[model samples]
Target: MSEQELIYLLALQKVPNIGDISAKKLLRTLGSAEAIFKSTKKELKLIEGFGDLKINSIHDSSYMEEAEQELLFIEKENIKVRYFEDRNYPDYLKHCIDAPILLFQNGNIDLAHKKIISIVGTRKVTTHGVAFCEQLIEELAPLNPVIVSGFAYGVDICAHKAAMTHGLQTIGCLAHGLDQIYPKAHAKYESEVMDHGGFMTDFWSGSHFDRKNFLKRNRIIAGLSEATIVIESAEKGGSLVTADIANSYNREVFAVPGRNTDQLSKGCNNLIKTQQARLLTSVADLVYVLNWDIQDQKKQQTQLFVELSTEEQFVFDTLKKLGKSEVDVLALQCKLPTFKLNPILLALELKGVVRPLPGKQFEVI
Candidate 1:
């Protein structure tokens, strides 16, 4: 793409309410972005949804300067720009008609991936919500799903940290851009995520974090991922918007149900009850839907079974038969202390012979 075309797309992004769909429509009608700039108001209005006011806004020279400056600042930040036409732009996202025209990104990104699941929930999450967020992703760690989230306070932060802790590649899709991180408290997590082949955002360098920008940002999170999971949400919630957007993109949506009467459970329960989302009780539920079974990844379970202590080896041998039995159940069956089971579980998980699941269960590969 040429410099003018690049800046023209940036200027189009700057044009309030002139989103991806409309911008592409105008670009298609005019043959090129430069033609849109050179055309008369009479010529531009021939396109749909271009009011006289929007036409004049596009003609303003200041829009060009703003776009140019935005590009320069992006260069300063060393943020790579992905145009909608770029083959490197997320292939999954490209299918969405409203996908952003340009993205200002930081960190390693391979937009084409087999599994992408976004974890979004209320920032004001309860204690149980926190535990589920951490444990569920920990269980999912073995599958190596490409975790995606908003990087918000409650569930998003937990999901990112958990993925990072397990050394997984996670993406933080921001309401703002690579020039700065929103909330600012997440700078540590963002820095660490970058180190682990993660990715940042869809906004440009100069884009400010306005409230409505989040509504638009949620679409990228939903569109990029194959599935979206709601950990906890109020009757009125942020994750609902992500769920709605994911459904709009024809992606799977799941929500973890909480205690029946908890305020945070309302949105999740309503979602499952109304058939808007599937009830996600375990990592298996997601892995099953995404078809990320380790059955193909199973080269030889024997290769993963070396160097285990007598007790650890015993637990491993037993789990292979039971198919995701709980630690207590394993202890009872093996006639051993489940208390001594933690280190053995970790060792087996590290070696890839056994996979952990929610509620302290383990499954053999």
Candidate 2:
């Protein structure tokens, strides 16, 4: 879009009570933001949901002045702006009714044919929650999924770090504008995140830094990805809000189950119990529920088995036959020494043919 068109869009965005949905309605009715501004009050009032007050705001010059100033800031900072109707705008977000009319982004973000998932949870994440978040990303590294998260403490940061550690692109959806990062302490990670993936938000440079902004930001987190995963959340938190939004968008929502008594697990458990989210245990669950190329996975599994040594194959076969069995039982059934079987099992685990369970039991993946 031209600078003039963008300025008009921004001016339209500045009109109070004219949100994304209303703006889109006007745009569809008039065909363009510039045309909307040129429309007479009678024409504007003719559009559904556009009251006399909202129609009058279009004639105010202050909004255009603000848009011009914001445009200057945008140009000065060299920030990338994506119009809602532009091809470069996020495909999934574009389908959302409340998605911003314009999205401001920075860094190298490429979403083409990428499997995207949003990871969210409580700010006060537990040790186990952190470990699970990291392990989940590590296991999914092979899939090359783009991780999306709020750039907050705990699960969000952990997901971003794990994605970066696995050399995957990650997106940080911010509550505030791109001009500053919230939680000043996270500033240390800003450069690294930008280098790996980058940050995104719909807020303008001078938008307020209010608590309500984070709640509004949750929609972007939920809308950008194919699925949203809740690692851990308390009975009430922003992560749950994101999960709810994702569900509302008809996107898959996955929540990791926790012990019933754990405070942080309550929200996830409630989500699962209410059928708002699928119960997530591992990457396999996500793969199965999302129906993500099971045939390809089977082919990969066949290739992996072909590369396994005789002993490794034997252990794999034994685990497959037993479904899930203790190491002692597996070693006995395979007729291999416990010591000898351990290495074989580890190799199979690394090959993704098998997964280890608690109490030394194992199961075929």
Best by TM-score: 2
lDDT of 1 at 202: 68
Please provide, for model 2 over 206-299, each residue's C-alpha lDDT reduced to its tens digit, 9 standing for 90 to 100: 6888989999999999999999999989999999999999999999999999999999999999999999999987776787688775344434
Best by lDDT: 2
- Measured against the true structure, the TM-scores of the candidates, in listed sequence, are 0.84, 0.85
Candidate 1 lDDT, tens digit per residue, 1-365?
88778888788877865778988888778777788788998887777788978887888888789889988887777778887778888777889989987876788766564567889999998888888878777766656677899888988888888888887788888888677777788887777878765665667665776988898889988988888999989998778998998998899999988777898899999999999999987765676677665654334334723676687688888998797798889988888765446545755765667877898788986
Find the 10 residues in a row with the least total lDDT in model 1.
296-305
Where does the lowest 10-residue lDDT sum fall in candidate 2?
296-305
Cα misplacement distance, residue 148 of candidate 1 (Å): 0.9
What RMSD, rounded to one decimal, does every model reach?
4.8, 5.5
Clashes of each: 0, 0
Those runs of model 1 whose alpha carbons end farther than 4 Å from true positions after fitting are: 300-316, 319-365
Model 2 segments more than 4 A misplaced: 294-365
Error of 2 at 6 (Å): 0.8
